[model samples]
Target: MRKIFLFMAAIISAFAISAQTQTIVIQGPNGKLMADLSVPSLNTNEKKTVAILMHGFGSNRHRPLLRAIYDKLSECGIGAIRFDFDGCGDSDGEFVDMTVPKEIADAKAVYEYVRDLPWVSDIYLIGHSQGGVVASMLAGELDKDAVKGVALLAPAAVLREDAIRGNTQGAKYDPITPPEYVELPSGIKIGRDYIVTAQTLPIYDAALQYQGPVLMLHGTSDIIVPYTYSLRYNDIYQNGSLRLIKGVDHSFNGYEKEAADIVANFFINTVNDYVL
Candidate 1:
């Protein structure tokens, strides 16, 4: 009985000190952006490495995918910070004001906030869908050594293609005279600046500049952003690898655990092999 009681106590103690997660607010380009920071309790005495997670268009940081990735990374002893874009979730801004450039700026702000942390030994960036584009572009713009690595999931590099056709969320308009605000099929309002900027944004060329290890994951059956987009990324990234999850959708809907595990392992392995 005493042995069994000790075993149960050990399990309970392990759970008590496994990980720590907290809600935080960071200053963004537009206003305050709500975020969650997760750190592994076991690494409290060591300088920790962190990954910043960015969400997709019309989505917030509290997304299930983001949450799953956050938990998984924390479980692997890495810190993670997932934040809302300036105009999404609990952040302060108007949804109509959202644009790729503005989101890049927002991400930069969050990056800066995390970069200066005394406990942080290395930094990595991960993004999904539109956020993946932002992550790729931002990684390219930063000093090569600034970010240890980058991971993109089903990046919407097609935004540039959509912009060239003057199509904003399935609604066509004259690129020359874009409406003040365009509503997407998801009911999110985007400004003309969003469409106009996409036409000129060089996602692929920009991503090529970041000469760091890159990992791209996409679902083979992704209808929104085809898997070919990630394939193109694999070709552009000098040190990148692409993994296709067979029969998975863009969001990896029912395969969240599998997708999260893959992503978490990629980061964990990269940190162990290179950053540490």
Candidate 2:
């Protein structure tokens, strides 16, 4: 029987040693990325679609939103793999050394791993916050054929603007000549490499390359990365839709289930269409 998990931590704890889910590690650009793979039961000859779940800048795969999505996907007979970026969660590396490009590389590594899985017939990319930015660019790089669908939750294209303005999550610095690092109010220090690379990132340019279906969900009340970013994303993709949930914050604090259901359903429908 397949078990359904609720919270990120609880689900992870229950599946850590279960038969349906397994904890795996993938080597990323910076180091190891600890990941959890949850799949529904299937015949040996049957291949399944899987979604790669990416968390935000200061978050990990174990985030409640990501976990909720994982649960939904599993319940719908879709597989999901959520992992820590090189520097976050149980993965190896330092947070200060993390950057967008580095995270992209890490995502690429995960992509390579997932594509090679014998049981995975199709793949989708889903991300939140800066992770959404990574998913967009990565899909753009891989094109639509490689990634069947994409879902961006509060994509943070504003990172470039933040870099250009010499401010990141309230940490100020000189855009022209950034220091070794700047620490955010949350005490996570980002390196100069992060700011320099973010300033010139072709976020939308790369993301727009993927002509596949895309679903972007953002909250009007989000202050971290305005919902307008998602609107702009909706404007670029060859096929894309944006949903602005009123009153929901960036993290979807009280709307996790709603957001996750929308995302899971998008992927499920896309998979069904492709199979047909």
Candidate 3:
């Protein structure tokens, strides 16, 4: 009987989530970005806050970690939009042509779309790994008031350093004269443009522009991108806090729910008023 009740509860929860989700498409720099915007099922009188969720390198909006965060935010009566950067997921671009600048453009396009929405009262940014870098840079590009707060999960600022070192995901190449493309161990080929731009990305210079509240959550055991990268962000931001989760990996493998809760709580506390 208990098992049956749990199964029924899961089904109901899935139904509720699907009912609130909306498919949105925005024209990104390279192509159309496929996105899912999850808004709380609130009445007209209730206030709504939305967050733009960005995924990491070679990841999609539907990644387990990202989806968990999206669901948690929605459950808290917060609106969240998770989208595929051009060349990833269901988007309309090739992965080989993707770059940091292009991903930023994709994020900017989504931000503009959200800013124009009439129902959204406040906006926040939440990103993981490479997506965290894109979110930081995009928030810096826009007005501080535009983004109420930012939450970065295992932000991968080490990409720039890796580019300078001519090594990416254990794939080594000559930084001075990189080939047309370098393929990762996963068999994904990144173009030369990605390497060249990553080598000199004004990541911190642009990220620190937004002097708003920043919450950085990184794991002590993250081997892909060291936790030191997030520490650097915390040190540079005018108002930033870093929380290092011991024993957690870059993907927050065993702590997905905890990581999502942190991001949801950060946005919840930052917002002046919300439905739930």
lDDT of each: 0.86, 0.89, 0.89
Per-residue C-alpha lDDT of model 2 across residues 96-205, encoded as one tens digit per residue: 99999999999999999999998998899999999999999999998448988899999999999999999999888999999999989998889999999999999999
Candidate 1 lDDT over residue span 158-268, tens digit each = 888887888766877788778888777777777888888888998988889897888999999998899999999999877787899899998879887787888877877
TM-score of each candidate structure, all chains considered together: 0.91, 0.91, 0.91
Native-to-model Cα distance after best TM-score fit, residue 75 in candidate 1, in Å: 0.9
In Å, residue 85's CA in model 2 sits off its true spot by 0.4
Which regions of candidate 3 are displaced past 4 Å? 1-19, 45-47, 271-276
Candidate 2 Cα deviation (angstroms), residue 10: 22
Clashes of 3: 0
Q: Which rank order by lDDT, best down to worst?
A: 3, 2, 1
Q: Give the least accurate 10-residue stretch of model 1, judged by summed lDDT.
A: 267-276
